[model samples]
Target: MKLNLTPLFAALLLAGCASVGSVDPAPLPLAPGAYKTTAANDATALTASWWQSFADPVLDELVGRAMAANTSVQAAANRLAQARAVLGSAEASRLPQVGVAAGAGRAADPGARAITRYSAGLDLAYELDLGGRLLHERNASALDVQAREQLLADARLLVQANVARSYLALRALDAEREIVAGTVAAYGETLSLTEKRARAGDVADLDVARVQAELAANEAEALALERRRLELETALAVLLGEAASSFRLVPATWATALPAVPAGLPSELLQRRPDLAAARSQLQAAKARVGVAQAAWWPSLALTAQGGGASSELSNLLRSGASTWGIGLLAALPIFDGGRREAGVQAARAQLDGSAIAFREQFLLALKEVEDQLGALTLLRAQGEANARAVSAASQALRLSDTRYRNGLVSQLELLDARRSELANRRAALQVRSAQYQTTVGLIRALGGGWATGA
Candidate 1:
């Protein structure tokens, strides 16, 4: 039997001439605009390291360490690498695959004859991509890689925010510890005065006992604050990829200055947030996948070339008379596979729809976070101011109470009460200030800080 390769070549050429299928771009569910909220002028510009606005060098260092060591950031980087490799693999489908082959063998007849044969050939196969299937796949893979890169960026931003928040908590606890220590000292002095008065019959034993109990409570509160600081340090250590027991965070005593928040529109969040950007890219990838799946419905055309030589002697295998070459076409049409192809297309369409929804959801969430942070900042600033004034008034009251007690004009109990109020107010002010600074950091994070605005 003789096989003619001409017809196969003609068919492949004809298939190449066939019109490529069209892929409709998926409709983006979210409008290409900033988010909207009831509050006007709530938008703020984002800085990349918004934490630096607090002017805490220790916090800056901690954030740098976490970015270098955080496991989640590393994981996102690894995922991006995987996506790039996948894209490379998809791209390879567009080029021809060629291979060389060689063989030698001997055969023996059952009766008496023996023969030797030698052969060698070059083989090639290429998908003509008549319907741009490989192109669609490559495009989808590229978009996936982009999406993964954005995901990595998002992870980094999250880690930065977490590290900053933890650092702020640690500083707040330190402030509390200081306040408690001062109160304990004040109580100790009051207890000493009360004890002397009791011995002199100027005051009752109850006054001495009351001062002692207050001192003990202040000491206990100090101890609790210490514990909280330690816990925060441990958390920060873990984020830096260190053993909590082995790592220690030095207490930061510097006053944190709040950074100015950039006023921006809600719609700016969509452009600034890496998570939102990644979500949009993923939606694009999903849309491209729909095209890839749809391409499955069209017939695929492939071209193959195989040439070889056969001879009784290995030396003559490459001779023209001993060599044969042929080209062939392979075509696959989906006849009926229980509707698998159709099902795949439908599934891809569903995935596209899901991605669109996810993108919109993410955008809206980002907007809400920014707006909420803005509102929180406004409230916190007012609270901080009120607390500051309260601290000042409490201090004045404590001083007046002390003078009155020394002059025998007020009871020891009144003096003790004034001291306690002063301590509470001071501690509350410290905490409120810390809260205000942390809220500012949150606003920066929500705004996507420096990186969000092309920093």
Candidate 2:
């Protein structure tokens, strides 16, 4: 059987048209010599397990649990598996499809006599990729797999960072709580002494009331800090893929080693982020699709083959006289589709353009993140020192004021002011230290200094 098809210059189509699939999908590459903000030393190299740099056993354990159990990471892994399956299908499209069949039936022959007809056969079909359309499609699918793999890496990195940040912040809250608790005890002692003096007629009741107010305020602040710490712990539990009721991070010493990064990092480090790599993969997949769209302008060719045997008896199905075979090639071209092909090309190109812009935006964001974190770390370091000095001065002033108040050399108001100053400065100093820890982790993540692929 035959049907009329849009005719092509048979020779030209067979020989392959030079301009048939001519579309260059220009890809973006990271700029050479990207501003050198690399790691400081060999020990600081970005590794798959970067959380180890902190040297906190609890943190290391939690991060490990998160990487293995986080829901987002598991979801990404599922996606990667799906992408790989899709890639396998795309690859199969480029290979020969073969099948076998056997059948027996009762039928009437030309003489109108009943007959038992037995048949067995094998068939094969394949597309000849003259325009690389199928090839591009397969390549695009492969890129999708790559992108998904990178996305999996990205999910792990995000979970790791959040765990470290939340844990460190919780520890900071503990430190602050300790400071407040100590101050509360001191205030309690002072209040008791002030009340005794009031009863002895050495100090007025106003002094006792003032001490009471200060003690209550510090106690309130301590409770608020505990509330915040509980919230952080709950968030961490989710990150670790555990039920909040079953998880608890008890208050302990914050001994996580704070690692420092170096100045003027190299350009190669810029491309290490999984998110950035995923973006690049997405762009390449889009580019491959553009090529697929371009290939659509060319004709498609297919090759078919079959071998079979037929006989009146099942035993004779493969007999010498019952054998038959044939082979053929076919071609198809769409003469007109009212600009549908053109529209496809345009859509694909548009997608490619958007991907390019997205890639650029990601690159710019990467740069800004690194810079912001670096600057923050520097400013925080200096701030920590200043807060330390303030705390020291405040502590000394409070000690002197307490002594003077006992001797009646300073008023109750002056002593209370000194205590407030010392508490505020001490809390400020703790906050600065916390910022340094949190910012260091941010710097590691923002700088894309973690999770090397295929590790």
lDDT of 2 by residue, 313-376 (tens): 9888888899879899999999999999999999997887777667667866876787677677
Where in model 1 is the C-alpha error above 4 Å? 1-49, 109-116, 263-266, 450-452
Judged by whole-model lDDT over C-alpha atoms, candidate 1 comes out at 0.74
Q: Which has the greatest lDDT? A: 2
lDDT of 1 by residue, 1-455 (tens): 12232343233222222232222224323332332322224333445566676677888888888888899999999999999999999999899999999887889868767888788899999998876779889988998898898889888888888888888788778878877888888788888878888899988888788988998998988888887888888888888878898998877685766565544443333465677667767767777787788888789899999999889987888888999899999999978889898889888878876775676567557656766776776677778789989989999999999999889898888888898788888888887777776766676666566424455
Error of 1 at 151 (Å): 0.8
Best by TM-score: 2
lDDT of each: 0.74, 0.81
Q: Which stretch of 10 consecutive residues in model 2 shows the poorest summed lDDT?
A: 1-10
